[model samples]
Target: MALVLPFEPNEPSIEALVALVKADMERVNATILARTGSDVAMIPEVANHLISSGGKRLRPMLTLACASLSGYRGDGHVKLAASVEFMHTATLLHDDVVDESDMRRGKLAARKLWGNEASVLVGDFLLGQAFKMMVEVGSMTCLDILATAACVIAEGEVMQLAAAKNTATSEDDYLAVIRGKTAELFAAACEVGAVLGQRPKAEQAACRSYGMNLGIAFQLVDDALDYGGSQAKLGKNVGDDFREGKITLPVLLAFRRGDASERAFWQRCLEKGEGNDADLDQAIGLMTRHRAIADTVERARHYGAIAKDALALFPNGQAKDALMEAVDFCLSRAH
Candidate 1:
């Protein structure tokens, strides 16, 4: 007999997920704060600069919610959830330094405030603490999952760097970059929960698929929103990707669809890195003409459908529904 949980319809929001895991999230929050502490003042200071920044703690929440949904009762999920967040924060700190980002979660980036060296060192500190928490969980499976995710994420960063400012990047190339950079951790976060719950191998695989597809959808929407959404919504300035010469899906599609003049414009702005603020507007215009942003959102919707289907094995329940709604939330960010 298949197991069935509970469910109720709600608006397109993450409120359901947040409400479902509110208690566990509180513990995750505490663990995050506790782990951020170190004898060196700058460690906590730099870590907190980004950690305290008001980005949605969605990755940790995904860990907690997946555990609850998997019927996990032990407290190990808390530690794992905190570890998940620490990994995400560490990535963001490193990414900001690498991207030369000016803002994060609407505040000055840690690299800007504390210098790149401090930011990188503090990021390493958080990663070390994250591993310590994983060890305390005593789950070798969980440790292996996160550790591999860390490596894949680093590889993704390097991949993105290699692809940077190159107008010839393909959709497959971009997918490879995002899969490593963003989706791997999300997959690990959800899979570890199923592992902790001692769910069957099939169910564990299903959870990983859900997180992976959801993460791809999440990043696709982010790429769309980089040119289409507001800073208030994105927690960073719009067109930052363009300014950084990132060849996202929207840009790829637009570049592929554009004429010689349009291609030359992209070559100058992206390949040559010689654009100004006005070029951003022109890039958006070109994207609009090519339906690039629209198609990117459409691509996200395709993954979102897969994400929802990935949960078919888990009966309809609050956890299931919340996880499903998170896909909607990711897609909705573009609007």
Candidate 2:
């Protein structure tokens, strides 16, 4: 018989998958706290501020779930999961700095409280610690996967910088940006679990594919949500991306499909960076007319289906089911 863990409902919740990995996650959490500590008062203070804040820890949980699903029975998965979280946190600190974002997780951004210099340095400190943890895990293959992902994520940021405020940014350009900044880590997080679990090369590739597609879906939904999602859940204002002049997929589609006068409106607000509250309202209206939100969600569902299919080799069990449900959860957030 295949391995089967417990869940209360027929349909699994992401919370249920989280529960299934509670034991491993406990170790990962401990590892995170221990690694983030520092003798310098400010390093620990700034790092812990974001680490302790109520982030969902989903990426790390993916690490743990993939390990368990592939029959991992050792402690290496714990350290690897912690490394994934550190990578994510480091990126968040740096991203907020780059985006000049005002809020995070419904609170004052660490940069706001501690200043930009502190935030960037703290982010660097987290990356250093994350690398140290990866080295200690003693899996060069895992280390190589994560290190490459880090580089790709940086490249993605640079790509976004190049594309920013360019109304002509193509859908392929946007895909490349998100694939690096968002999906690469998700891919690394799941791929490393297979490595630690001693899964075959094909299984490892499958895990990576699953994570990559799911991450794409997740990001697409986020793009939609930024224009239409509830701020209470998002911890930021609706149209934050628009205010920043980001050329997300929704805007890309609407820009391409709109009339000449509509293109001029986009040029005035996004291309010229003259956005105001009323301008954002108009942008949302334009997206609505062009069916950008619905289309984006439709694209997300397409990727979500690919993510589901990627897990076909895995047996019906708690981890597999949870991971499958996770694909649904990523898409559902837009609703």
* Candidate 1 Cα deviation (angstroms), residue 50: 0.9
**By how many angstroms RMSD does model 1 differ from the true structure?**
5.4
* Whole-model Cα lDDT of every candidate shown, in order: 0.92, 0.91
lDDT of 1 by residue, 74-193 (tens): 999999999999999999999988989988888999888899999888888889999999999999999999999999999999999999988879999999999999999999999999
lDDT of 2 by residue, 283-317 (tens): 99999999998999999999899989999988889
**CA shift at 124, candidate 1, in angstroms?**
0.5
Model 1 lDDT, residue 139, Cα: 96
Any runs in candidate 2 off by more than 4 Å, and if so which?
Answer: 1-12
Q: lDDT score of model 1?
A: 0.92
* Runs off by more than 4 Å, candidate 1: 1-11
Which pairs clash (backbone N, Cα, C closer than 3 Å) in model 1? none
The per-prediction tally of clashing pairs is 0, 0
Q: Which pairs of residues collide in candidate 2?
A: none
